[model samples]
Target: MSDWLDEIHWNSDGLVPAIAQDPTSGRILMMAWMNRESLALTAAEGRAVYWSRSRNRLWRKGEESGHVQRVIELRLDCDADVVVLQVEQLGGIACHTGRESCFYRVLRDGQWATVDPVIKDPQAIYAGGHGHD
Candidate 1:
């Protein structure tokens, strides 16, 4: 039998874009990259796991912040290149900036506008100091 991972059309870097969505609010929380191991771990663990390109390692969501995403469902786009995860975002935070989502900025009058307010102080969220995505 073919492996389920084989069905995904990974990019040249062997990574696929994964989007995390709030299952209840239907709001997009954040997006991350996933490699085969990270994707498999997410399914097996029933939580969100992603490949940290900057850290060059498997990043278990909320490992540092205690804001884990409990994945309820996983879907693949028609082209089988993108993945979406319906998740219950713990602690009501998803962005490293302590915002509800990474998409807090909107294009307004050709300028980026910050709409969503930071739910928590990033300094309180990250003990080692913020700036992680």
Candidate 2:
């Protein structure tokens, strides 16, 4: 059967690295994994859906934290081994840590430093006991 998913060069575990980017700022928000089903669902649903390796299931962005990513565009890398989603991050938060992005650390003097401040308290964001990470 002909399928668009076949074009992607998924890894042995049937997963591809997906990057989420803020279309407005062009800043990378997060990176996650996506399976065939999740990618297809993301396209159909017009949202960012990822494969949660830890949970062993599909994860719809903002499902628990109300930080949904509305996908603006989806792209495959030149190698066809990576997926990138240009998205409008809902609530302006993309990290479970309540920061704007997951890559919030800066490497300085051979050490990692957290430079981004949490816009909203994680305690307040995940008040209902939903796991963020």
Candidate 3:
């Protein structure tokens, strides 16, 4: 029998864009890439797991930080290229920049303006490092 993972149309990099959304508020928390293994792990573990292109490995969401995303639902777009994950953000923070969402910048007069405040200092969240992988 064919596997469910086979249904996805991965890109040339063998990855798809995964969007994490807050189930309660419907706010987009973050966006990351997911490979076959990471998507399987995320489903099996009931948490968010992404493929880190920079690190070239599986990145478990909140592996370092204490802000794990409890996945409530997983949805694939009609094209089978994009995925949307409904999750409960444990620490009320999502962005590596310490904001609730990665979409913290807004266009104003053709300039990017920061709209969301940092919920926690990135220094505090990453522990000696500056950002997430």
* Candidate with maximal lDDT: 1
Question: lDDT tens digits, residues 29-122, model 2?
Answer: 9999999999999999999999999999999999888889999999999999999999999999899889999999999999999999999988
| Model 2: how far residue 103 lies from native, Å | 0.5
RMSD of each: 0.9, 1.3, 1.0
Order candidates by TM-score, high to low: 1, 3, 2
Give the 10-residue window scoring lowest on summed lDDT in candidate 2. 124-133
Residue lDDT tens for model 3, 27-72: 8989999999999999999999999999999998888877899999
**Model 1: lDDT of residue 27:** 97
TM-score of 3: 0.96
Model 1 scores what on Cα lDDT?
Answer: 0.95
User: What clash count goes with each model?
Assistant: 0, 0, 0
- Models sorted by lDDT, best on top: 1, 2, 3
| Residue pairs in candidate 2 whose N, alpha carbon or C atoms collide under 3 angstroms | none
lDDT of candidates 1 onward, in order: 0.95, 0.94, 0.92
Best of the candidates, TM-score? 1
Evaluated at residue 105, the lDDT of candidate 2 is 97
